[model samples]
Target: MSDSVFVGIDVSSQTLEVASSSELKTWQVANDAAGLDALVSRLLELGPALTVLEATGGYEFEAACALQAAGLAVAVVNPRTARDFARAMGALAKTDALDAKMLAAFARVLHQHPERERFVKPLADAELQRLQALVLRRRQLVQMITSERQRMRISHVAARPSIERVIEFLKTELGDSEADVAAHVQRHHAELAAALASVPGIGAASVAVLLAELPELGRLDRRRVAALVGVAPLNRDSGQMRGQRSIWGGRADVRRTLYMATLTAVRHNPILKTHYERLLAAGKRKKVALVACMRKLLTMLNAIAKNGSKWDPSLHNA
Candidate 1:
């Protein structure tokens, strides 16, 4: 087998199905700390080029962190892109072992690609991980509060009181979650957070989401940053038939936060307000203008992060 052998592990709630490119071989192990250690040891023994896994929500986190801590090159790919690759290769049938094979092959191609290094983002730092957890908890609390509010409005007289209590409890939790996010950022990522927050129209919530979700914010080019956040316009040209360019997928959490911040920026921030007005006066729809502002805002933030520079409208506008 070549020294540059790619490996894949399809992680489920109970087991990890591992596959390797060296000899197209695979095996299964329990999805636990012991199994993860075993898997890492086995792959290291094989001298892998890299390991790949689809981001199965939180299932892949432990293994990824384990591999990363072990100094292995690991890539947690988007599930949608992995599935599309499987479809392209006529591997439509689904099974853990099969997924392991597909992922191994995907890893091989991904590593060989010119831009492979761009896909190899380091896992979040411990502080960022903690921030991510708090942010996600805040999201859950917000969702629960919303659900309870809806239920309270349409519930029986007795049920209304119970739903209201739940809503109140969730609201309290949400506030605390936000506070934890603030304290964590101040303790660990204060400078980065401050640089981003210095920009007009960006709030604590937006800064928290960016710090937690868009770790690539300052690490890439403006175009890559925008695309990563799902704000870039994608081409849709076929022969001579030009189709509308639209964004489809990226970090939806950061994108959603940016959307709201852009709403405010387009109205108040001098530079962004002018940019928004120009787009609108150019006959672009209000929604399209707003989305462009989102990209512009993100790109500016990316620059600010990269240069360790605080927000300056003059530089950004120019």
Candidate 2:
């Protein structure tokens, strides 16, 4: 048998189901510190060419980080991508063990994929991870506050006081989370934050989210960055049958933040505003024009981050 091996791990909150391509062997381990340590040790012996895991809402982070730290190449892929691969390969059944094996096969193919680097990059460092946690906390707090407000509207008069109290507490936590995000950015990412904030419509919250969720913002080219954020329009065509081009999957949180920022930019930021107005004048719908503006704003930010420069309207005007 070839010494080259590929491995896959299906991660869940409680256990990890692991499979290896060389022998088609499978194993189970608790998804905790000791289990991760043991798994790393075993992988070191096998010396797999690549290991793949699906992003199970952050459940796979610890295992992925552990493997990466142990000098193993790891790719954390989207679940949708994994499922598509499974269906294409005729793997209809679903179980932790089966998923792990399918992922092993996916890893074999992914090893030769051109864009594998997109999934195999280094995980965020401690400080940035902390910032991401703070940003996510703030998002949760905001959602709770919004829900409470909605309930308050249709809620009984007797329930109003309780809802209001919960909203107040959530708002307080949101403020604290915002403060933490700000302090962390100031301490670790002040320069990057400042550059992003120089754009007219990008505010502190957006800056934090971008830094936290879209770490590849400055590293990739404009198109790749736009695609990564799910703002890049995709084309569908079959033998001269052209389908409408539309944006598809990418980082939703980053896209949401970018959309909000673009809303403000189309009204205030001179370049984006002009571009938006031109698109509308040319017969584009408001939503379509706004999506274009979002792409433009993202690319502008990408360029700024890449060049380590601030937003200069003069240079961009042409």
Candidate 3:
């Protein structure tokens, strides 16, 4: 096991910096089809035990997926996690080569972690990948519309026409993106989407986000799923001082969508509403209580997905 190799790849729009833990060797390749194939072939020869890369927005997705497809054990971790590991190891310098080397060390540690399997899973398939792209495009269009609307509020009367034109265009694009998302879900994940939508607060948008961004929602246990979505609270205790427990790292995009859905759930979903009110009655703050509701709602959804069941008021409430 000590003789096993570990790899790290620092991915960018133009290049990928590669490193190995077994030696002082490091290399770079273009971030294109040819580069990815060459990197895969080289790693196949090395046969690393694990490969780690930071999630640099969308840049790392292709490299990670390509490596995974080549039968490599790839872990696409959050950038914050990798940075924190580097800081802990006293590797504070930042460069593509240095980052790659740090990631190689991080990969070795992560390979032995108790929760390692959580990071080392298959990337989304082609269908889910397409759905994810559409989902992200919808988000971008919504942002553009929002920005245009805000600009309209501050723009002079003469500039209003241009802002309005941009807003209209963005809205049209948003609608088309939404339609694409719906069609993709209906074609590929109708059953799962229908089951999730059975929950009162979970609308089509939320369902699409979950199916695209959180492929592990149903496969993981309640605790794992909650933690993965950043709803699970963590202890902030010290040697003699017990501090507040707060949620930490997880999928931010998923958490945002879940939080929005939870707000609606607390208002309309009977079970969630009751649970939320109960927490408030117990003297929890509004935000705290709301977070609790998010965790509960997530766990409920997790159970529904795991059991292939729809939301049943009688059973769920019980």
Candidate 1 per-residue lDDT, tens place, 91-196, comes to 9999988999999989989988875544544578777788989999988888888888888778889788778777787888888888898999899889988999
Higher-TM-score candidate among 1 and 2? 2
Higher-scoring candidate on TM-score, 2 or 3: 2
Query: Model 3 residue 263 lDDT?
Result: 96
Cα lDDT tens digits for candidate 2, 146-216: 99999999999999999989988888888888998899999999998999999999999999999999999
Give one clash count per candidate, in the order shown: 0, 0, 0
TM-score of every candidate relative to the true structure: 0.95, 0.95, 0.94
Q: Which stretches in model 1 have alpha-carbon errors above 4 Å?
A: 1-3, 116-122
Question: Candidate 3, which segments miss by more than 4 Å at Cα?
Answer: 117-122
Can you write out model 3's per-residue Cα lDDT over 135-237, one digit (the tens) per residue? 9999999888888888888889999998988888888899999999999999998998999999999999999999998899888899888888789999989
Task: State the weakest 10-residue window (summed lDDT) of model 2.
Answer: 114-123
lDDT, candidate 2, residue 92? 95
The best-first sequence of candidates by TM-score reads 2, 1, 3
lDDT of each: 0.87, 0.90, 0.90
RMSD (CA, Å), candidate 1 to true, equals 1.8
